[model samples]
Target: MFQGFNLNVSNESRFDSPSTYDEILKSREDNVRESLENFYNEEGLLNGDSLRKEWFPEIENCHVFISHSSKDRELALKLANWLYHEFKIESFIDSTVWGFADKLLKQIDNKYAYREETKDYSYEIRNYTTSHVHMMLSNALNSMIERSECLLFLNTENAIRNISLKEDREQYTFSPWIMAELQTSALIEKKQSPNSQRPFGSLESNKTDIESIVKRAKSFQMIHKANVEHLNNITCENLSEWAKDCNGEKGYNALTTLYRDYAPGCR
Candidate 1:
């Protein structure tokens, strides 16, 4: 992904980089776009050729529901971004969409008053999606849940487990078909808490480089903070290790000087 040994990776987003690993590997952009495009064309799942086409989410039965406790909204958004950009997955969150939809509805009904003298008038009708557009979105959302191969819950395992498609708030909001469709969904837990993992390369890679990093006289603490500044100089093993180590420590010292942090005290 970093453009490897022989060439420089054109400083573009890693997600957009060319796969170029081998003749068989497709470029990242092409791969993601193909996954999205083939969703309608190849399988006949969406049955294209309509004059008015809407956004057809890929991943059959895999309409990714961003299930998270209200506390994790920020993290949920971040996860949604990654899922959409990295995996070309469909991620729908109600946060931004709800706000915009609400504002539009208010403007249409309240702002344009037919009566100049009275504050109240004909009815407070809200501007909403065209029936066709609403139906399209409804079908897409339901299809996402129905054909969903997997379900990604953002740090809400307990809530998701306790959820009832038959008699729950979620079920009440969406139609019965949509709720029932979630039964086929399989949950995939990310498991890494924001404060837990360092969010970088794996840990085993760091084990091998710990000896060299120590030999180089860098602070053992600095080596483990998961800084991307000297990323090329460190191995993933140590970084993941540090993040894991840091998860429970009272202070910075508790994070460093673990058995894995040193290699025979050459320093």
Candidate 2:
């Protein structure tokens, strides 16, 4: 185990050396976020041009939220600067010193025309900033979901993993010791993604939730019908074009039947 800097990875930390990917992750969880910072240092992990041109509230331009356990502020700041240098990523760090949200809201309220209305806007701004900070934490934990990606997690476990830290009581206590929000994001992606096959069976056998599937089917039907009609309309520019020749009803029925057969809840 390569031990240096402020912290040391003892035998109790994990097996042997940081040879495998999981071992590397487990080692970095020990308040040493250097590994996490290094991952994003990749050449094109965060493409500034594409981020600005394609993604809204662009990562290349927008500030990232950095949520750190107060004890790990130094590591958080180091990580934040790392992001800024490589991808032009602006990181908002929340630390024991000062959570960025409160500071940002104060700045915003100071500039707001409505002094009395600042109270409500203050609350809203504060919440929004706080949310980003939390998002930063979540993103660090699950590298699979970029804060940019349409990865919407409604119900899930906290992104950070618990680490046993010796406390004042001389006993072990589990704390959120994770520093790599990106790795955590990756893990979440693993969970959210559909793995076709596993040792036990396919994902289909154990499925429960179906609303998202139904909604997807409905959306696909709409897109498919529109594409079909558009192609036909472009191919034949007749003034006498009518629905009877277009098979609009049949297309609708086929789409409806196909959806009903598989998507139970689609209306």
Candidate 3:
């Protein structure tokens, strides 16, 4: 359990220098490159466990889980990099997991779910496979959210849209994955760290055209309120202050700085 925040951040905001941001992107690319090797085994077969590991995030270095829309991926990446550069706080971006889930599904369907006779994939088997993969990915995301000390949701226009249903204005998100993440953040057990004596804080949808998965998401009535009222709503300005507070501090103390100013009530 941890603290969560909904930040109405500017997508254009650049928190780190160009070179520094490039370094962050390079590092992420390198990490992905390494993980790519694990997709196959000695027999050149898709290793299910290895693919599963991609969704089952065991990120020891990450203290934050960034939840945002696929369109705001660059922004989320920038925020994650900023957290690391400013406060040495690593963050887990769910976009990567979504990618891996797609890859895993492609590998499975290409291998087993296809039918040469019909010149198309077996719809039933594909559905069965996707259900399992999505379940794992969803559970893994929940796990990451629970394990991290903070969750920062980038409440940008790209993430949510305003809808007026019968004169009642409400927020609606197109992606069911985002809906699940927000709901999980809302209901998950809120646990304070042992060091709460100090302070506190803080998915992308599938891209594959596999059986028109995205179309199915659109058919669902996922009307969310973009409920961040319960969370501490912070701005880029507040983040700057948090950075200033972190200037003289080190390690966990720097993180505590955020809790002190924003989540003093957490114990």
How does each model score on lDDT? 0.32, 0.29, 0.72
Q: Which of the two candidates, 2 or 3, achieves a greater lDDT against the reference? A: 3
* Prediction-by-prediction clash tally: 13, 16, 5
Ranking by TM-score: 3, 1, 2
**In candidate 3, what are the lDDT values of residues 68-87, reduced to their tens digit?**
99888888877877777766
Off by over 4 Å in 1: 1-63, 68-71, 81-90, 94-96, 110-116, 120-140, 155-267
lDDT score, candidate 1: 0.32
For each of the candidates, the C-alpha root-mean-square deviation to the true structure, in angstroms, is 22.5, 25.9, 5.9
Model 1 residue 46 CA deviation in Å: 25
TM-score of 3: 0.78
TM-score for candidate 2, please give it: 0.22
Stretches off by above 4 angstroms in model 3 are 18-51, 194-225, 264-267
Choose 1 or 2, whichever is better by TM-score: 1
Query: lDDT per residue, candidate 2, 1-267, as tens digits?
Result: 000011111221121222222332233233322112233325636343232122112122223344344555544445444333333334434332133223433443444421343222344654564464445433333332233221111110122232333542221112232233322433332221121122110123323433455367445411000011101111111201222233333222322332233223332
